[model samples]
Target chain A: MDDAPAYSPTPRTRATRNRDRVRYDAATVHAILDEGRLCHLGFVADGAPVVLPTLYARVGGVLYLHGSTGAAAMRAARDGGLEVCATVTLTDGLVLARSGMHHSVNYRSVVVRGTARRVSDEAEQRSALDAIVDAVVPGRSADCRPADAKELAQTAVLRLELREVSAKVRTGGVNEEPEDLDLPHWAGVVPVTETIGAPEPDAAMAPGTPLPGYLRTFTGASD
Target chain B: MDDAPAYSPTPRTRATRNRDRVRYDAATVHAILDEGRLCHLGFVADGAPVVLPTLYARVGGVLYLHGSTGAAAMRAARDGGLEVCATVTLTDGLVLARSGMHHSVNYRSVVVRGTARRVSDEAEQRSALDAIVDAVVPGRSADCRPADAKELAQTAVLRLELREVSAKVRTGGVNEEPEDLDLPHWAGVVPVTETIGAPEPDAAMAPGTPLPGYLRTFTGASD
Candidate 1:
């Protein structure tokens, strides 16, 4: 299992060799990808590189990303046959140190690189669209309106198989130098957390409408 | 002002005709940079490209980023003389639509491309460290212990001048097709938000020591 099959011709990024920090196992990679709702995608467009933050969802081994038909970055991904690099990060806390040099943040991040292709099949696009919907709000695809034929035809969905993926994470208390530990400064994790607040019902909602159970189920941060 | 001074090579990733979105104005560029705390730094390392999530802070016309002194990505940036592309994004909300195809998120993001140089000057490094501290927690730099000589020498800081930067944003309701407006699907902004919760005092804090005002002043999400 250590000697896995090589996936692509483009050599893996040199940073991939940090084997201690890089997790190549499928379960670890999927866990990070599944929990993240948004990804920052980087690709070279024209001559200079551009990084665009976009919504994405993982289904099986592929990641489905879609955007407006008019978005130039989306258009470039569809037409240029570009190699796309993507990352998703979740920051858990702020590590405050006795010394400024030791300050850091606790975070989990995954980076994947692959060639993206537009999802061509109608049935596949529909499934990918549903995966995207469910990615943000579990079981939302059935409760919400599904895409009609014409709308699906105009929007573009690109599929990048999660072949070359890795997750890197850093967590825990401040790592201060031994000499500075005796200083009078405070040193600990000032935990940074994300949580959902009470839902603000739309002003125009009809009198009889009630919020969905799924909405009620969101007690803490999703990612 | 329309015909600004041209550099050797025009920004190729910039959309030629979308001048309004492609901001050359330094004020507009810095505003985007200042508003966000994390950035996605992209570069071609070895042959394939890599993107890493890291914390960054902007000051004057320069951006400073730091990572583990042993991180290969930072080493490459410090030694390989490669151009680096970095971007920061703030997700305002999730835009759910009646049609799956039209579902999207509202966000503000900035992208910058330039060659990065290792910061070596002592005064500048200290100032850069201060900018990062102030970026996360205003006035905390003054309150905390400053880095000692040995600690300062172990850290790596890189500077990227904000000479070429652009911001692209999408906000408000989903742009649904005309015919799908009447569809029975729910359509509105889910209104994603990030906010700071009550700070958890360190377990080792002196009994009854009051929390600092700057920590109490965090009413919004830092990320």
Candidate 2:
């Protein structure tokens, strides 16, 4: 991970509450973005807010989103490009405090707000596609059959530059109040983790096909 | 868990693509919602879309969002109500396919598109607060000190009924092409699971404070 350039917060991206937890560094933003497999994409449709969970990838300063060309969010993002907010969140732990009001979740989330431009260039789209696939499985994209021309034409990829981005991270001890510290309640954190299970091959797979090296040690964390 | 009432799909809620994967039943929607501790809350701000991850609770059909009174999203939902789309996604696996374009993540997500009204009733808001706390750790709210009037005044809760809702699920095997089955690549799924680790006591926790009964086998799943 080359030290990705940092981002200055824009007016809209500036967080209001818990200002101390907000981070503007690209290291924090990209680490959080790269770990998650899905992003909740937010866009306005028919003058109403719409949020859909979809796959995404970050290559340097750009974030790529994947969807079928016929999907509603893809169609809405066509033509001159659509203004969207793509946010990826990774849940860390559940914060249990002595006071009910102090309860919260320890998480790392990044929000990229900008116009998502539809990729029309064939080469750019292919690269973005590779990133999307490899982002989930570091080297599995190379092992798979590449997308053909027909397949490329059917997929819809949106490119959004990570400029107005801010990552909000909460990682620490319980913020129990002084008076409630002595209460008979659990004041701690229940750590949450994402683990990858053993690979289950498709029934139609050739029995001789060896499991790729990438799958053997795939801990699901970006290395 | 009682069977919540089902909701008929409206024009906007009806998905255009992958209609086969869509379910209108209440069980599917509630299960996906309750299992998730955070929801990506989306709202239109200055005619631009914004999505933020926040803690939430499901008390029957209504979803309550927890935030500080000074939060931007909470302030936007204060008056009559704020048009919002709350989405909760639980990733299941990393689907490995023969073709790169066919790669996808198996996930269960619920999208509740409606207006979020600021909860003003004292009794209702208090109940919602308990539900939010207990939702993270079952029986947690009862053991902790209840929120006093001053604490309640500082918190913001938005109530969004689960009327315009839909759950999209992708649980089956890989959708590999018939032609690509001959490819010498592994086609299968790497199961992804969310597991909870042992509780870490706070540095300031009293030595005599026993771990609560509810945390003995906390699987982090909604019980």
Candidate 3:
């Protein structure tokens, strides 16, 4: 796949030169996207720029994003093919340094650019929704209430083909300058971890409803 | 402020819609920026798109992002004045539903569009670094080691002026369909939070290095 022709506009941004941080292989890009639950989408609206935060799921080589049918962003994308830029990120830790200059955070993220189209076909829409359901909770669509025709009608799903994508990541200890190595102040990584705590049943839940095993089994997966 | 002349661009793309979800008042935009410690930046390279996840700090109306002087994205922006879209997000909870369709997450995010410029002045570079330090720990800049001139020379800081910015936020419980109310499965938000844990003293530190009171007094401040 290394020799596969890249998408036409797949030029790396000038700042992308961090050879050590950029990941060009498809698997790395997909891994970052699969593990992320939310994405920030940027597109040109009117003569200005707009960014929306929304839930997303990946299937094959495309990503699906949904919003209210009446949302302006959705309307714009559906009405006119828009060049969309979307990004997903997962922060891993806070790098606390002995010097103020070196304080930083470690993270992984993926960005994609493509023209998004509304998933108009009913069959495709349903499939997209299924991908979203499974993306949030594996095997969820099989266990829970499925979306009926009415619910599906109220939501708009946009599909962005992930033809142009890249992932960047940073990890490890703070980079302390040699001159400041002798400072008495401490320097190290304050690992940031996401944990799934015990589930809280809704007040309206039935008395006998037991917690789903899937919920209990989650060990704070990145997504 | 509402009447301030909006920024305009040449050859606007379809993705730049002026919608509520992608548009925000100045205060809301600033709040989102202030509460985030990292950002995912997106831009087209070659013909493909790339996203880089990195630490950032906001000062007044400008955001400061830094990387090794050799990064591609930074070099692209610094040399060619590339257009970039960036996003910052904070996830607040996990919304688990009785049905697969309802699984979702609640979050707050901000997206901005602008051309990034390299911070060439030495004083501004130092100040930007200080802002980054203070952004993570309120009183850290004064207490920690300051960046020396040589160390500062190797880092590159890019400033993105907050001219065209928007913030979108979703907070609340699941919006279950009326018909699914009686489902036997549990439904509610599992609040997710990030907090500072007890600081572990460095192994090489002197035995009596007192834990900073500030580290112990964390109030789960947003960010």
Candidate 4:
């Protein structure tokens, strides 16, 4: 297999502190993005900062976000390309250090800085939308009804190239001061895990629609 | 019981797309913020947007963030009050609509717009540090060793009052198209739950150190 280009972080995406935690490999960045279900999208709106939690999907080297055509943020990005910073974070566990100052959380996060533009192509739009559905649950796009022409017309899709991206991760045990290590306080990690619960069927389901294989074994990206 | 002031939304915090999902009550916003363990902090640096995932705690009406005093972002915010947009999101489930266009995720999210200033008062700073610790695990600050003067001097705490904030929430079943209702496809929600697993003790833990009651019965913010 051909090697992918290294994700060189620009000034905007570079990790200013904890420089050692930064990861530049494309595979590592892609894996974290694929495992994430949501992205906190940040943009400058009306000369002030604004951050919104939204659904996103990564297809190859491009990230796609879908929303209504009339949505304010999407329209703002589509009319004139908007500079956007999107971040995805997965908290693994609470790092219980010996001292209050040393307490931290183990987490993996990725930040991407890019300009978002409208995806006007019909075929690409349909596939991008499918990629988002399948990102939520694998095999969901094929199992669900596809979007029709009218449905497609009402939705707006924005594409962001994964050029300026960086991933930062903190893992393993807690780091505490050596003097405080002997203190009479418990120091360990309490794992925070995401588990799939029993899927709830729609009340209007027609008869016995078997629970799809994917839903039965669904474990979200956090694990 | 004394009532809290309602969090009025400025143009920045308003939910422009889904106005119906916007919430103004302080209680609702505080609940969402307290239940969230992490937040995506958005700030502009050198005329570019940046978003970082970090731990935060909300005590009463003030939100505090603790980190190294020399960290670039915290220093920037401390030297001259920096405009910040902090967001916390809790994803409840994935809404699978019949059409790809309608696929959405059930989530509760809050956006706060304010200027972050250095927490100078020593007393308040100590309490803020404790709040940050207990925020991760209830009653953790009291259980852990308190920060020494040197530790306190190295740590920088920043406070942002919860003045301009708004919350947006989407719940319930999938919203499928009327025409697509007859399509033979599974449409439901796969609930996503954050659960606590068995706590792994530190390798260097002294034998016979009993796991605290709080750790034994730990339930993270998300149920």
Candidate 5:
């Protein structure tokens, strides 16, 4: 938890290929995790792998996962800490190349493999819910109605400490062979960005209801 | 392989909660898969689950996964058909609700679980490579130089049959309690879209290289 210390790579977290693109620093890991509103959770179920998408938030070194209490994965984690792999990816651009073999997508991704335990502490659970909300839109939790007792009972929250993690990023322009540079194929990077459009206010709200300050400044992509 | 038949659910594939949001039809499954350029592959490695993002394409009822031959997942599948779960998710909007408990994401996602084997057929391998290129941008395979023997030899391709598959979708407006409708919160969907910016040609390319016709009409979001 020092300002920006490197997470020593575990044997499983080390990169086998693209060794240069792998980053072990905590800053890169936190930035990627914070920028994403969703993360895919992978776990073993019935002795087979199951992957599901869910909302997540990072508070300090722990990553909170939100789901219904009825969810299978949530139940499994609640019984005992469930071994899981959580991954988040943000697309940067399309890497077009002169040859089909070289085409790739420029993206930043982080994969964390460890045990995720259910948040049984009431205070920690409530705060984790708020952090999850703010993770999507900063300051959103304060604007919305807090969950009541019944609602809280129905919700399931799990936290995975960022113990074993690593990041892989691909950036820059098209990569084509020298011989294919003049192959008459246009090669370039097409910048891809996620943007939020105008908000469609709830029809039942008052006609003069103003858009919240946070909504006005909301952006789909991180700077 | 029927055009519109529903995929029968197995005990594992059946929805345990929110059954209304789960889908088993082929149409919904195909649409979600085709709209996404990247997918998360979940596989058990060294007795633990591992998740990695990679480019993918669908041909008929099979999903073609692209990765370097050196990748651990690729090597595992090539040695023998590997048990894997491949998932693709497309974020349609952000669902803002009146209470924190009701907050959710508007998305379309499909999960396919099966044993994926390394594609060894020469004809299928060549076409799968083309299909993967075209998955990012339609009609792109014909524009670039086809992979030669050396590139093909280095590339590893895996195909997972779409047998045990299911789709889960969340769409439309916020879901809040009847009592909380007047909570003064901004509750609605914030449109999210993936957009492409002007192409940045490689610096090494000729100054006057014209943008290809496909590039001129490229759009990040599928229509």
Candidate 6:
């Protein structure tokens, strides 16, 4: 194990509530980011906040995001290092507390505040794209065709270093006040999970192309 | 049917890429928001974008979000009508394409841009809190203890009108180049889904309390 120190959270990534749930350890932050497939990217546009869902992957200490070169946000990030916030969240269950005020979701989330720069190196960009594909479904890149020169030129990949990050997590059962213990309502957690469904083949596929082992044994988050 | 006109997207909520995916209909936007269990709320802080995961609910055209009264973001929203952007995303599948550039995730998402105000009215606050509980698990509010006066006062609720909202949806098979169709690799979609697992009773629960109907039959988005 690398004995590196934990990330130092800036004011932006610090937890303002439930302070005990804040985790600055790299293991916790990376685990949550790896489990989540979608991230809401927050950036200021025209002096107002804008949030959009995007696909992302993490390699070592840097996270990569990709989009069409023509996209406005992608263009902004590509022009120069754009200050942005990327967040990934996984909700584990719904905590049904005795009182409405205490009801909450058991979740693990990571928030990162950094600047995203366009990746100009072709080899690194190609590998970043491959890592993103493997992030979604492991061992996927080997079975797929690589991007051609034209395709690579049309896509923009932005790299953000995970320098300022934190993971906030809540798990287990509900938190109820001692006075509300005798309330007549049933209270517990209803666990939420994300699972992989069966693979769907394309209509134009060769008749006997077998489903690869990776696709056949696919599982989410737990992997 | 009320037959009211659809929401008109401001420059903020409009989709910069894939304009065809943008939907201005209130029905589409509301359905996506109702089905989602959590939202990534984006708001500006000290000229920087901050995004956090939070639970929210919609009543008619208004969306309500709540947090601890001491939370910084909540306090900011309560102090004044703060410009906020809320986004909900449901990823459906991993679209494996013949080329790397064409790979994508099948998803449905909604982005709402509006100003959030603190809800101070007692009656409205109570119902909003109830709605939030129900949003996590439908019918939860009726089966759970209501919030007391003190709990209500300790919590802060912010309301955002859904006047500027847009839904972006992408479905179906991968979009691959015609020239790459005959590539020797497999290309198809691996469908993804979110579901609820069996309820685990709390350790201190009354011995004979049964799992409610809503918890037993919980289904996610597609359902």
Query: Which predicted model would earn the best TM-score?
Result: 5
Estimate the TM-score of every prediction: 0.83, 0.95, 0.76, 0.93, 0.96, 0.94
For all predictions in the order shown, the interface RMSD in Å is: 3.2, 1.3, 3.7, 1.6, 1.2, 1.5
lDDT of 1 at A200: 43
List, residue by residue over B25-55, the lDDT tens digit for candidate 2: 9999999988998899888988999888878
lDDT of 6 at B64: 90
Alpha-carbon RMSD, each predicted model? 5.1, 2.8, 5.9, 3.2, 2.7, 3.0
Worst 10 residues of 2 chain A by lDDT: A214-223
Off by over 4 Å in 5: A68-70, A219-223, B69-71, B219-223
Q: How close is chain B to the truth by TM-score, in each candidate? A: 0.85, 0.93, 0.83, 0.93, 0.94, 0.92
- Between candidates 4 and 5, the one scoring higher on DockQ is 5
Candidate 6 stretches greater than 4 Å from native: A1-3, A68-70, A219-223, B1-5, B68-70, B219-223
Model 3 per-residue lDDT tens digits across residues A7-102: 233554223354587775677777788888778776654433445566888887889987642356677667876677778887777777787767
Return whichever of 3 and 4 wins on lDDT: 4
lDDT of 4 by residue, A1-223 (tens): 0156568777666666788888978888888989997888887766667777767899988999765423666777768877888899988888898888778888888888888888889999999989988889888889887777887887787898988989988899889888888888888888888877667778778878877777666733222
Most accurate candidate by lDDT: 5
In model 4, which regions exceed 4 Å deviation?
A1-5, A68-72, A219-223, B67-72, B219-223
Query: First chain of model 3: TM-score?
Result: 0.87
Off by over 4 Å in 3: A1-10, A13-16, A67-81, A219-223, B1-32, B42-51, B60-86, B97-103, B111-124, B150-167, B195-213, B216-223
DockQ each: 0.37, 0.80, 0.31, 0.71, 0.78, 0.74
Between candidates 2 and 6, which one is better according to lDDT?
2
Fraction of native Cα-Cα interface contacts (under 8 Å, chains A and B) also present in model 2: 0.94
Predicted candidate 5 versus true structure: per-residue lDDT over B105-176, tens digit per residue = 889999999999998887899999999999998889999999898888888889999999999999888888
When summed lDDT is taken over every stretch of 10 residues in candidate 6 chain B, the lowest stretch is: B214-223
Top candidate (DockQ):
2
Give the range where candidate 3 chain B is weakest over 10 consecutive residues by summed lDDT. Answer: B6-15
Evaluated on chain B only, candidate 2 has a TM-score of: 0.93
